[model samples]
Target chain A: MTEEGQSEIFQKMWSRKGFRAELRAASAIAIKQWKVELSYPLSVLWFIIMPFIWFIPYLIAGTALTGSSESIHLQDLTGISDWLSYIAIGTAFTGLALSLLWGSGFALRREQNVGTLETLMTTPMNRETLVWGSTLHNLQHGGLGVILQLGASVLIFGVSLNVWGILPALAIIGLSIIAMQGVIFAVVCIVLTAKQGWMIVEFLSSILMLVAPMTYPIAVLPPILQYVSVASPLTWTVEGFRGFLMYGLAYEGVITAVIALIILDVIFVIVGTLLFRATERLVRQRGALSQF
Target chain B: MTETIQEPSTKSVESDMAYLTDFKPRIMDWSAARVFATKNLKIAIRYPANFLVWGVLPILWFAPFILMATAIAGPSTSTHFTNISGFDDFVQFSVIGWFVFMYLDNSIWGIGNNFRWEQFSGTLEPLFTAPVPRISILLGAAFSDSIQGTLQAIIMLIFAMFLFGVEYAITAIFPTVLILLIMVFALYGFGFMVAGLILVFKDPSVLTQLIAESTYMLSPIQYPVQALPKSVQAIAYVIPTTIGIITVREIAINGTMSLPAFVQSIGALGFLALIFWGLGMLSFKWAEKWTKERGHMGGF
Candidate 1:
């Protein structure tokens, strides 16, 4: 509480070495959470199993449904006979989006409920580091779900892919998740004030699922809904992944989607950080952080 | 001699024990089933935002798709699609089908996962302590969601009527309403089953998503079920939504429901409703027991 101690804290905040230390600390925390999530076998099974079950039947049905039609083909949509691959990608991205939103958004509330939020905050680790660590933890948890679903799509549906293009598709997926995390963090700020984060979670999960271009293409959506889909990062990620993996990277649209994702990520991070900082200050002054 | 030795204090204590033994739960409160239903209704009205998100939002969501499909397929396409069900306008078919499915999905997923919100809000355990059965709590939540879904569906149907310029026939109104009622109960039974899973698993997101996404493919929403392969068609008949969608479409577009079709569709839905409702109740009871034993009724 003394001036000398405050000065030391300020000094620690500013140094290059201190910044690196914070990043390392955040990474460690993120990794630890990811490990804990991996320990849940049922969670892993649910993520992978359900998508395969749904998508495989659809793939088989799709072939029969479209057998007479010449316009849409396996080669035309995603270079796979199994429409399950397309559905698989949609399912995977959805899992990722849901995880990012729920995981990071709920982290603080969970910690607070467990009576650990204050203790964690009291530690010397910077708030930014904690936020980053939580976001990373979410990404890893969600990313694993997506990967498992994708793998199941391949195995069960017999859907073949270029395989090499998966890396870029993953990068795009990561960026999309990061962008979504920003929006979720802002919502978390509102949640902190209202103490209605769970309602927000319910609303977001159900609403977003309908609005986003997850199950069907944007083409299936009306003009207005199409715009709504475009506004969501998940739509672009779905389209971009479809373009890169299914279309053999021939579509120039993937570039635009990737660029959009990057911009969204940067904007979201800045906005999330600002909202978090403002909320943190309000909580500190009002002593509301521990209220829940 | 013993009777003569009895004190007033002992007599009072004996009376108190008799009072405790004779006490019975009031008949009105014994069931308390409506409490769960009422609680859900109250929550829905109290939180209009949740209603809008789960109920009204789906209408908004499918609005765009409906408009474009109508624009591309033309108003007459309804006649073509309806020949299967007998309704003349495809828009009417879509309006009824989408709204019904939307409500069903919202109620099922909403009630199933209601615990997550309660868990996060730190109210799950306190709620469990109440004498009211947990089923009532879930039913209350489901009722709220269903009301929202119903309202949204009505509004969407009205909007579609105006937007697509489809005429409503009074003759078919009774059938349509009847079908809606059947769909509602059938879906509720299924929703409760999903809710039961949530009780057991603590997270129903995965199961909910699998069912939700797959339903769109299985149901005859955008296209006729006959468009699906024979194998897939067999599977589709097993799902209540398929019959629900077809029945709604039949009344909306075809203007007549055949005896055989009605019997088959209603029978299929009745069977499914019975199965899901039984499973849901059983699972819920098991979950209640498990939670009590494990002390995780409160913990997320």
Candidate 2:
């Protein structure tokens, strides 16, 4: 290209609100994360492999507790003798939820640990874009993991599928992720400020796994836990996915869930953004961006 | 900071003799292990809340299974489970499985990731030059991990029994404790292997996570091994936790601990520990050599 033409392209790229520049920036951050991750090949292999293996506990628990492929209580609770499918769906969403919780939640902490957080923050690019890039990378990997595991589960344990229901299920999961991001933004802010928050991550991961009926019905929990479980957006996400893919809820029920999810998304995003901004301002005021 | 015999300028005659005597690595050095173990415990105690949480929060991992068991059979009795697996109290069965797994989980993860911590702190190279036997370092780390893990496992077991209204007998507890010690031996061997891997490969938290999850799945941590598919069962047997968990749960759930089975499992665990420990030592040495050659010991 001529110098004039190149300059024009560069100017357009430099302009704010330009889709091309935003895309390139996000892509760069994603690629950077991938390269850093791939630098440790053993971890890369595990990242690709562990997401599927994460379900073994639920599967083992289901089989061992019920002692068969069929469960009378599971049948009574969800009206399905196909406990394997029920468990698979729960496990799949749980992995996705995990992606949101750890994958995105700790992205900034990772950058900080690598000594790159301050550098990224000082760049001309927006910080949220970096977060979005990291989150999408995690989500993409996580979503693919759930899909691959779901396929294997269908073949190995014989989970029933309406392949067509995947679109709607994906839609519901997509909406749920938006809601999750709001909550995660708050978590990310706190993690960025806290000291070596790995314990916090583990605590959240285990707590979320237990609180949400990812593999079992929420009704099984104590009365107090039941209320707490229902309050999680993932409860609705898993329930909606189960209803859509497993039990086939009516259209009205699906619409009601979608609306509820939308409301949650708005509330979470607003509160989350506010919390993050407050933390960010405090961090800047104290000149602590480079400290952590 | 003690000098080797080769460094005559820095080595006094008495120190040289001490170094020479320890250099052969024929005699075990309990002191070295104690030092490293104390150092590790001190580092851990730096963040007491974090240390405490790791012991307590693992109980949360057990919560879902208990909740699920309650969902399946209403927390009272499991008729189908009894018919097939010879146990009615599924909560007791699951609690025992997860409880035993705690030792394996803590040992494997703690020992493996200890290398990463050393790397991150920029001290792995000095550690390599320490005159103490490498195995002692592994044992020292494993020693502290076992303390925390064993405490947590007991806490989890008690919490589980109380929550599920399950009861344990002295008969079951005695044999289960024995089995747990054997399992810890085997797990340390595996931990050494992983630590060796981390020593060379650098921080592989994802790999450790994978190993932990795979261990949980294949070991019948929340279920009976019989529930796994035939192929998975064959694979599961290769992991020492599978046998250990099954044996431990058999004691708790049946309330009739079998001596022969317990003794046999202990033997199997010892065999695994021997193989893994040997391999782990060799791997750590190899990884140390690899890192020193590459000058990447501090390259996390």
Candidate 3:
């Protein structure tokens, strides 16, 4: 209430003890979410099946149009002769990207719907703590789903994966998830301020799919979109991922992709964090946290 | 002091009993439907971003199919696709398919999720308690979804026409509209069935996506049914949208179909529409009764 009291509270919030408390809070939130999700086993089953659901139409249409599994043009564009593997990998990654994007992007909205956002905001935990917890939950959930989905694809569709590429692919996935958290943080900022923020998330998801070469080579995109894709961390992740797993490209070949993703990770994370904190503070001052 | 309550006279009690027995509930209430429809329309229009997103989303969805098709075939056309589909313009074929797919998507997300969403928002129980026919609300939601889907599809179609240089036959518009109307009803039946499933299950997204994606793969959305395997094609024909989309393509895109085939397609779709609508209504009524008896209507 007093000036000195307020200053002390701020100092305490920034202390090392406060950071540990935030970490614990984030872990608790994530575990709570997992408990809620695990209670719905059917929903979990559907989540695993969803990647296949989305991929089938693309495979069917591609095969029908090309009259076979192999595409000469696709080979020419991406240096991969197997269209099945290309599409399977892309679909699997898209599934992961969408899960993370929608998961963390709507994390705050979900809390609000459950009537907990206002209650949680009253605590001493950092706003980023809540976001981080949701993002961490999504990362694990999505990562597991991708593994199962890809495994099923390989078994059912006869698609092959480079066994040795697993470690590097996981590393790239780790980097991409971190980079994507930045995007989700910015989305959370919008969610805090707007009623139709999910619409923006949907729009962004589509834009990401369009730009990230999810189903086709980047070379197929127009020059402008190609430039945009090059700048996106997701594009680099997908490129680096496919480079190792699909094309058997070595570490040396994918160094540029690795470097690009690292730079993008730093940029997006910093910008996303600053923007989210600013937006969170603005919404609090405007007394709009509970409006929705 | 203890309060004393007086009992009503026998005559008054008889009159109250008569009040309950005298009134008959209608099978469908058009006035309530108008209210529901108007409310849904107002709610939708209040958020213009929904419309913007709806308009743009189809194009965004269509991009992958187009890009992948181009990557597989060629930029302008694919001879293999043309051979089977009887049309070289994948863009036009895909655009038309995407238009139909939009209605399917809307019906699932909109009409299918209608009751489930109401339950989530804590309004379904109140709505059920009201003295209105349930079918009226379903119809109202269906009407709203149709209006929104049609507008969104038109926007997407116009964009595709200009962006991809797709052209349609002017004379085929009448047939296309007729087939579309039939397809819409069949889809309405599908949506109503999904709505019932959601009512009983109380899990909307997974169920909706399951039905949507299954139908999408089964039906000839972006490709001809001929392109599918023989066994799969047989199954595809049984799907309501399959005949409707194939017939529309024949009339609109390929511009040729024998008179017998045309008649067969129409008759088959008409039969499917009846079957789906009848089954959907029955299932929904059964689900409502089942949930109500179990005291699960307000449990969401």
Candidate 4:
């Protein structure tokens, strides 16, 4: 494009050219991310394969503990005796959390790594557009992971799913991904300041694994930890996903999950945007945007 | 002067030849290993946050398994597990398993990724060209990982015992120590080859992740090999950690092992230690030659 056209575009973007301009910028970043990722074919395979890598050990443990697929104790705790499906589906949902945490969390750091942070910051595109773009990229990869994991579970363990449950499950997953954006944004701020962003992710991922009911129900956690679990968007997502798939959870419970997730989504997005913008400004002022 | 030179010629020439023949660079530089290990460790120590995370990450990582097992069966013991593996307490079983798994993880990721880090930092070429033996560099990494992994593993194990109410046979400490020593040697050997493979593929995460994950699944870390299908168990035995976990657990958690089983476990680990270490050295040497020939050592 000509310099005149570029300046025109920037002028329009600066004037708050509505959601379309922001969406365009975000999609451009997403496309670029995909292009870079697709260059490494093996990494794409690993991305899809990772969920199964995590799921198998839990499967073996469950089978060994109960000596079968059914567990009466589990039934008492979660009203489900099929531990296989419970763990498999829960593990699949964790892909969303991992993608947001690892992918979007390091989005800015990644730009810094590639020597593009300065150019990116100079652009008139809203800073949150970068986050949305990375999040979109991660969601696609995470979604692929979920699909492969479910397919593998069905084939290997004969896990049955309710056909009607797919839509609600997808909805819950989408909301959970959005809710996790605030956490990812907060993590991005840490990434800007901390020398090793991975340590923070390591701590967060561990906490999520414990509290999210991925391998077990929240009832098994201590009373204090249970509150943490209750507050996590992941816990609600898993519960709702499992409820529709196997537990036959009530309609009221589904509504509650949707409402809770929607509230979390709105709060997280707003807070995440503000936090990211402020951090961006601070890093720019401190001349630390490209330090890492 | 001519008369003196005639008299000294035979002895002087013989001594000069001997000196030339004797001059050679040291094959394995222990000093280089020490330097490299110290440097790597100093860098690690500077990052206190990572150390803190590593110290506590294991408990958080393994809690889900223990909790899941408890949720399925009562917290006391699994009758089926005891029947299959002669261990009833899943918490102790998995805690020990995860502890051992950490060493394996450290060796593979630590040594393998060290080379990648070197490449990324634009030092791999210079380091390779240095006078120090290449294997010493990997050995240094192995030593650093061993030291760091050991401290973290001990702390994590202690915390796990208190948090989950896990108990082990204090009497079994001696045997467990011996088994762990052998396991470490075998793991470092495995790490050597993994480092070599990472160099060849130029992709560390995918290959290492595949190996680590596959090993976790094939090994009887979380479940008994007996619980696995016969064919799967056959494949599981190929992984050193499977036998290591079974042997350590047999002695530590189950209280004792049959003499034959004990002998078999020790013998297998010793054999693996030699085989893997030898293979590791050969693979690394070959990879070095291959990478240099292709001029890919400096290409990240």
The prediction achieving the highest TM-score against the true structure is 4
DockQ measured for candidate 1 = 0.15
* Cα lDDT of model 1 by residue, B225-249, tens digit: 7667678888887667778777766
C-alpha local distance difference test of each model:
0.66, 0.76, 0.83, 0.83
- Candidate achieving the largest DockQ: 4
True contacts kept of each: 0.04, 0.80, 0.75, 0.87
Model 1 chain B lDDT-worst window of ten: B67-76
| Candidate 3 TM-score to native | 0.89
Tens-place lDDT digits, model 4, residues A1-292: 9999999987876786668878888888888998988888778778867898888888877777778899898889877788889888889877767887888888888899889988997877778788888988888878888889989999888999877788877877878878888888888888988846787777887897789987788998999999988778888888888777763434346987888788878887788778888988898899988896
Residue B13 miss distance in model 3 (angstroms): 16
RMSD to truth, every model:
7.3, 4.3, 5.3, 5.8
Residue A82 accuracy (lDDT) in model 4 = 87
The TM-score of predicted model 2 comes to: 0.89
Pairs with backbone N, CA or C atoms under 3 Å apart (clashes), candidate 2? none
Cα lDDT tens digits for candidate 4, B1-300? 455434667889899898778856677899889988898889888976666567688788778777888888877577888888777677788888887778887887889888888888898889988767787898898888888888887888888888878888888899888888988988888999999987888766777888878887887777888877787888888677887888888787867779888888989999989999999999999998898899999886
Higher-lDDT candidate of 1 and 4? 4
Model 3 per-residue lDDT at B216: 85
Which portions of model 4 miss their true places by more than 4 Å?
A: A1-16, A247-252, B1-22, B25-27
Chain A fold similarity by TM-score, each prediction:
0.80, 0.89, 0.90, 0.92
How large is the interface RMSD of each prediction? 7.1, 2.1, 1.2, 1.2
Interface RMSD of 4: 1.2
